[model samples]
Target: MSSRNSHSVLDLQSLTREQVGRIFSIADGYAGSDVSRLATKGCGKTGALLFFEASTRTRLSFETACARLGVHPLRLDGKAGTSLEKGETLEDTVLNVAAMNPDFLVIRCGDDLDLAALSSQVSMPILNAGWGKKGHPTQALLDAYTVRKYLGTCEKQKILIVGDVRHSRVAASHFELAKVLGYEVALCGPAEFLPEKPSVPVFSSLQEGLSWATVAMALRVQLERHETSYSLKDYRAAYGFTVENLKKLSAKALIMHPGPINQGTEMDSEVLQDPRCKVLPQVTSGVLIRQALIQLNCLEETL
Candidate 1:
């Protein structure tokens, strides 16, 4: 097993199964504790958060987590008031934020390489929220927690990742996490949108891929990144998991998606609302996981 203190989780590929389990345990501790009491006691407060990209769930969760731990969260949303609109470079923005003497810095940026670069320059602990096409470590951590919660253990489990893998940071993170946890990971999508040279198996057809898998992870197709004229109709025909396709999955298989789901584009609305789907739990776990990450990084620095 890899050492837990080795990295700041800029990428999911560096984390081992043991590290994932440890994160869950930490989350459990926070979950069991009384947040109101913690807020009153003010155990250990720290840092600010910087998000250079758009976010919904991640942004809110981190804010809530910091509040629960009595930490002051200073958020930058990249608007008129922020230095970014005034033509400041990413390096300068990060450096200026770090100069606040905050104990930790949580960043959600569009570039994965930039997050890694910023981590090296800063003295404070850095937590990656979501980076472009590379990885979302917190998302992966929560995903593993959800899977383990619903399916006992990940060992020998089969997981099918469908839809757009080529431009999905979530898919990349899931690939590494599933691999570490001993899950049989499979990628299924159109040949053009499929991941290139995946570490595990790849299936051209979603039906074939869903046959032996216990989990189905569907990713949204990023229209902004596409140069070709890829219509929703054509994309759905080739990659979308309709209600009919959902029936083909194993009865025990759980449906998952990293929202906001393009309902008709990547999956049918019915499929998302299916009884076997764990999408809501995934969202809830995201909050818990983000909270745990903040506490862990902050506690590490203090210790």
Candidate 2:
């Protein structure tokens, strides 16, 4: 939003090409043995992790990033030990957290809260962990980093994101970021699952999508977010990514997933074991990108 040392990464759409490059550059510096060396920079800083929804990968990686940087990660998982469930509004909880003056806050909010409104009320920097059904900017950053790490460049690369396109923040963020990052992204899913009028190409069949993509990112079906019901049997039969589906992918094509996967629905569990699958690699990249975010936002002056 503002210059370095004063801004929030609300969404990837708001990030500039140069800004994206800077984030990637910072992540590259901590890509390997350099992780433990940056502890001094974040020695006393504290970053708050305010997660309102259930999470596995995102939450843990952010915590791990803060630890690696030597920043104390104070966590308040939705209503667990906090007064949130006893009727304290998310906005009020955030305002209360802000009053304590943490260096930065990594928030994962539910659909009801207006993050932008709450963000305006805070003094500390805010990083959007997950943005309703709109976008997951940090996830996009990590995914982009993984792509660069694997393919050496993102320019003109093809990534076909398969399954549950309608409710996936991951797909929305990546598709939007593609415009600035110089890559082509396609969406493939059941008719109800796909967006009604996506700017990018859409495919109904997974096989057809894999034929054109160098990266196949299978998205988890968001039953929690869906307003209408659909048949899992029918959906899986048509769009499930399995080892058998891997044959359609080119030798160099990468397979990815934003995890906590629906074992037999979005993809078969066995597909995760494939050598070309980069889901775990994506998780590893997530930590480094978050470390970069922490440095840029929490340890701003040192950079």
Best by TM-score: 2
Question: Alpha-carbon error at 153 in model 1, in Å?
Answer: 1.0
Give the clashing pairs for model 2: none
The residue ranges of model 2 lying beyond 4 angstroms of the native Cα positions read 1-5, 301-303
How close is every model to the real structure, measured as TM-score?
0.91, 0.94
lDDT of 1 by residue, 86-188 (tens): 8887679889988876767888887634877676677777788888787888887887788888888878888888877888888888777777788777888
lDDT of 2 at 35: 61
lDDT of all the models against the reference? 0.77, 0.85
Q: What TM-score does prediction 1 earn?
A: 0.91
**Candidate 2 vs. truth: CA RMSD?**
2.0
User: Can you write out model 2's per-residue Cα lDDT over 144-201, one digit (the tens) per residue?
Assistant: 8899989998889999988888888888789779988999999888788888888889
lDDT of 2 at 132: 86
